[model samples]
Target: MRCPLARMTAETPLRYRFVGARGVRAWIAAPSVAQTQTPPRPLDPTEVETIAIIGRPSSQIAETLRRKRAAEVISDGVSAEQIGDLPAANLAEALQRVPGVAIEREVGEGQFVSVRGLGPLFQSVTLNGAPVAFNENIRNSTQSGRQFRFRALSVDLLAGARLAKSSTADMIDGGIGSNIDIETAGGLDGGPFLALRAGGEIEERTESLRPDLSIAGRIVSPDGSKGLVAGISQEDRRVRYDRFQIMRYGAFAVSGAPLTAPNDVRTTVEREDRRRRSAFLGADWRVSPNLKLDFDGLVSSFDNTIREDRLCPPSAPLRQIEGSV
Candidate 1:
């Protein structure tokens, strides 16, 4: 049997349908009996519009590595996004993530930091390259050393932090071990954005929750040459600490032989209510293709209300052991 070839005529009908897109409904289009027989024409170049898309993708790790590679000295850093994603509450806690850096805790919160096993006094910390003063309200005011307390500042207001392991001519003195600098974003650097964050901190001893809140925003000029950024944060924390102290180890004669024993023993319990507030403001101006100026300012306040109870030996009666046994 032979099959006959089919021919299309104006009388034939044609139906076409297209898949639906997001926010668009699918529909069927049927050609008119007269239009189906018309010849196809090429599209006109002048009538068509050309569209182009440009994008630059960035992340905290990439930005950090870029800065590290570009810096003149041996340095490590963390970007703002990385800081925010970390499970850290304060600047000291965040700095612990850096290699060869360690932190000292007080009342379960990081307060002092050391670099490469060097003490806190050997390291220097700056806010936007400006020196930060020691906290006046720190415990044992008379014994306050050169170590700067990290408890006074909050992590939310920073754009990034850098730790320099080597010395540089432009850096300020006093950082024989290392230098740390925390920076805030300027208007043009952050672009135009507004963010509000809220969270809670739980203290295991009291079984109570504390509140934390922060607001950050940035505005850029229409010309894109100037901008300003600001951030404010407030946090409340409850801490309970128990401390045992052995004042000194002394040699005691027991039946003829000398034995080492603790001279005095003491115990203390501390309950603290801490409230911290920090604010940051920064502006950026691009004067020329190679010249850019930045201004950054930061202020923070830390309030600690403590209730402590101590048990100690009596000074006059229990202290005197006149002759060696």
Candidate 2:
């Protein structure tokens, strides 16, 4: 008797299938079909070159000009040192090129930036076009003897900054020294553009490495009705500073029979490490060709720590720690 063929079902076990059998052989023997190939299209070298040469469109150029103008206005008349580069570690370093701006260094690094003849506390700093006033607990006062430090604000977040020496009704009421305005850009253009910058420096005296990075981009719709822009940056830096402090004694030396030494000598050394990070986001709605509505948001954070030590010879006992750390 002939062997019976097994019936196939959707759920049949794999090991039970019939192989090399009469029914399977007929179903598996089918002829192969041929596929036709299409000819390749030729590349137009001229068109490719033209597209490359055209590069960014005219609208993009205009947007670039606008940004340049804004930066120039903010830096106008400022010294090269003061405005050396936008993303400096602190206002003092940023303003070093400006005339009348003085920076006190500790251990060959900038400790504080002084404007005109005013102290650090006398200066006011603004962020994102808004004033960053001191809290009630940290109010500004001469007697308080506390001052603002440039390291407190993030340099990365600022696309541009302006130092205003003269007073204006629109500015903060206080600050005989100067006012610092920090601005952020909103990435709201409907075009595709990208910008990236990074650098690192090694200081010989401090033996420290400084590194910085920044990225900015914009996306705009073809119709130009809407756009988005954004920027982000971070920096890590170390600075050294050295300076002298003067101490006076014996105010009534002329009248008194015996007077203490009229003056004392002292030296100070300081080391500072700072880290900063910042981000900005902005959107634009084109209400009209010449007029548009823009909204921007910015966030920035900075951390700075200083280490100071004083040394004097054993014979010169006059040197002593005077202030609380």
Candidate 3:
């Protein structure tokens, strides 16, 4: 049976009823209902096709997740694409994005890394599962630990970096905080790849523009059994620093209490010229599915030259300077 409301039409007339003294006080009008129509049926499914999407950024993200999941210990990885996306000057700066990772800066660039609130001495750095020699600036010998300086290496020479926070049986023993493994791409990792970069940066204080150039490429054999990767980069930069120095502090009696004042005030201006060059070569050989040999070698050089000028202003003698105490 159809509903009563559904039988109502739009053309229904109005009706009025009069009570004893009210006289046609209330007037009722027929209610109008909107018609409802059935919705269209969905189309039938035809055929199913598979689509594979591959991109540099997306592939790198997928690979990072895969590496993180496959590791037996607690590990985090940063891909080259991710590192390149950031405005970092060195590998140490790029690594600051990872959890529990911190960097030490020198000369306005990241030089060392500390992991999990521990100093660099407690952390170990390796390249392709092998220990790399520690490289430091000759001018500074204060860093006498077995720490690896990240500033010595360029980010363009790396494919990815992984930090393992937990210990495992197959790892080296020196890392009490964490172990960092730097990975390089194999020649066949991507069919064929080449990158070239040339740019210039201007210093704020000096207003001088410096040039930076880098080139990297990979070549692989037909059978994909052998591959070679090589990259080189050079950067020339000039940095200036202005600082105020207080050689000593002295106490003087003012009114009734002793007051502290700076003694031997001096101003210094320092200009530094830095030149860095880095190169890396990698080889991947798949002798068999179970046995493979990978070789990665890196060479880097850094030159630093600094010139400084100082100006000192004479102050009152310490013996009677504002009633010394």
Candidate 4:
């Protein structure tokens, strides 16, 4: 009919531990006696404490999630939580805390992270263990190497994100920098989770405002066997730079003697505005207790326009005039 209830202790998280039968059972407190099955006691202080402690139970589910993550990690890694709760303009800056992690910044904002001093081309970025496309939000699309642009990403919806300093056969290939795998929100990660983030920054010189916004969440079935998560992020930024250089052209000889002069000089000012949008989707199903299936997708688009003002002064090399003489 009943058995001694499991004791509540911090050493072992709170969970039902049936000693007797598993089909259907209940908890019954046993009182101390010389040798008796029943004692004359409604409830005692000790028994009362036990019942009260059960009311506030530690979540075994949370512990399960922690252990699962630990099992999935095989090498030295950096998780999003390791990034700490601090002010970061982009994911690249958030990753700076990881050992051997370096980031490249564009217009004072982090754009890419290099692992172990290796450049982005050496690193591979993945979403939920799947490769995300290579769409960098930068002025130069011609930039080389395989890399993900951190500037276009928002970190609000990740269940877990990690950069693996090493790799195994199970991991996807092509990351000389590091293999950075990001896990999206899943049914087990949370219940009815919703997150919204928005922020703005002002440029000192141009006095222009840059804005970013994102929303993400996950919804799960009642049994926690299936779930779906999706998110979208948008950002607008403006950048400026100035440069001056002397243009060199072929020069003529001066009176048959060798001579050369700068042919032209120019000063240029440039300004660029970029709008980037990124989105992600995730779905998972626990097919039968052991077999599980998951899907994740990521897409990004960037539109950048640049304006330039240039002034060039024309000059002729004196070598030509000397050769004529």
Residue-level lDDT tens digits of model 4 in 1-325 = 4333434433343345446665533443454465476667786556334343345533433443465478655334434454436766556787776667888887677888887778778888887677888755434566544678876665554554667776767778887667887666555555777788888767665689999888888899998899888888887878777888887765667667665666788899888888878788888899999988888776666677889999987686464453343
- In terms of TM-score, which candidate is strongest? 3
lDDT of 3 by residue, 1-325 (tens): 9533335522455454556774554345645554235456899989979899986647888989987988888999798999998777888999999999999898889988889999888888888888887645333566557878788777888888989998787777888999998888776577668899999989999999999999999888889898999999999899999999999787765655667898689899999998889998888888998887888788888888999999988874544334434
Clashing pairs in 4: 122-177
Give the lDDT of residue 181 in candidate 4.
Answer: 78
- Candidate number with the higher TM-score (2 or 3): 3
Q: Rate the local accuracy (lDDT) of all candidates.
A: 0.82, 0.61, 0.82, 0.69
For candidate 3, list the clashing residue pairs, or say none. none
State every prediction's TM-score relative to the real structure: 0.68, 0.50, 0.75, 0.62
lDDT of 4: 0.69
- Cα deviation in Å at residue 66, candidate 4? 6.3
Superposition error at 219 for model 3 (Å): 1.5
Better of 2 and 4 by TM-score: 4
Off by over 4 Å in 2: 1-87, 106-111, 133-147, 152-157, 188-192, 201-211, 238-273, 289-291, 305-325
Off by over 4 Å in 3: 1-57, 135-143, 250-261, 287-291, 313-315, 318-325
Scored against the true structure, residue 170 in model 3 reaches a CA lDDT of 78
